[model samples]
Target: MELTYKNSKTIDSEQLKNLYNDVGWTAYTKDIELLQQALLQSLEVVSAWDDHNLVGLIRIVGDGLTIIYIQDILVLNEYQNKGIASQLIQDVMSRYESVRQKVLLTEEAPDVRHFYEKQGFQSCDKGDLVSFAKLN
Candidate 1:
């Protein structure tokens, strides 16, 4: 199967939500509103496609110049081990490498780490970070 990756304005929210769920990632539960905002926020985002199907996605949320946080590296289960996700990351990293190349938070998968390591990301135990959550 041929793999294609690209930066897109297309936001197939339902397809993404289903892909996320199939990959055992947390369910966003058809949150089209959030996906709409996310699609708007994604800077230099990359997606993997097999024909008309969206098999994978990687979102970069940050200033175009610096501090790109790589999140939501989702690939459909059937498409795993095909190196599509790696290509997606490479697509994002190539442009940002010259500016700022620090991936703050990753989903922490060994297979994923192996891919990143191949791309030159060393394991770091302690580093700068932050988080906050609010519920009503």
Candidate 2:
């Protein structure tokens, strides 16, 4: 399979839908049309395509060259544990090498946390920036 990675500058609406859903984030469904606007300038959307399909993806949202927040790391179930996530994250890291801080948040799952650690990320005091939605 041919592996490919591209940034937000190259992504259109259709590709966004495919890659976002490929990572198990159905919540993005309602936001499909808004993704483009939400991801305005300075965001780098990283995606890995296996020839004919989008298998993995991650988005580095940040103010170019300073600090970056890595988000939406999704690897299709069929492609999980096969190093596609690793490569996708690595590629994103490289693309934002100019940034002094790179961050991401995931529900406190052991396996999920371990995956991030494998990429050299350390757990730290996140401070007062986290909030959750209240389902009515």
Candidate 3:
């Protein structure tokens, strides 16, 4: 597959819905308008496309100078294991290389941990740091 990557906040709504739905991220797909606005407000958004198909995406948010939060990273199920997600992450990282803190919070799963660890993220406790969240 010839994959093309784009760093743009503008994305077709249908493509965004399809991609989020493909990955079963119902929280995003259930409210496409909110998702789109979130992307517009993000510090950066990197998307992977296979021709007309949106296969992967990585969205980041926060002040670009001191800290950046990795808000989302996803690849279609069929497209996983092919490095698309990694490329998306790399695109964001490279763009914000000077940002002092890069942070992300994801579900606690073995594969998830391994993937982020491989990409140079240490678990919060590893650095004697703790994270808190308030999700409704």
The lDDT of each candidate is 0.73, 0.73, 0.91
Clashing pairs in 2: none
Leading candidate by TM-score:
3
Q: What is the clash tally of candidate 3? A: 0
How well is each residue in 1-136 modelled by candidate 3, as lDDT tens digits? 8999998898999999988898888889888999999999998898999988989999989999999999999999999999998888877788889988999999999999999999989999687888988998
Clashing residue pairs, backbone N/CA/C < 3 A, model 1: none
Runs in model 1 lying further than 4 Å from the true structure: 107-109, 126-136
Ranked candidates (lDDT, high to low): 3, 1, 2
Q: TM-score for each prediction?
A: 0.80, 0.77, 0.96
Backbone clashes in model 3, listed as residue pairs: none
Stretches of candidate 2 off by over 4 Å are: 8-15, 40-42, 125-136
- Report the C-alpha lDDT of model 1 over 64-128, residue by residue, as the tens digit: 78588776787898888778877777777777877665664566788767777887777665356
TM-score between candidate 2 and the true structure: 0.77
CA displacement after TM-score superposition, residue 68 of candidate 1 (Å): 1.1
Tens digits of per-residue lDDT for model 2, 1-136: 5688765445566766766676656677568766666656437766777775767777777786778887578877787898988998888777677778887777788898788889988766445554454554
Worst 10 residues of 1 by lDDT: 126-135
Task: State the weakest 10-residue window (summed lDDT) of model 2.
Answer: 125-134
Would you list the rank order by TM-score, best first? 3, 1, 2
TM-score of 3: 0.96
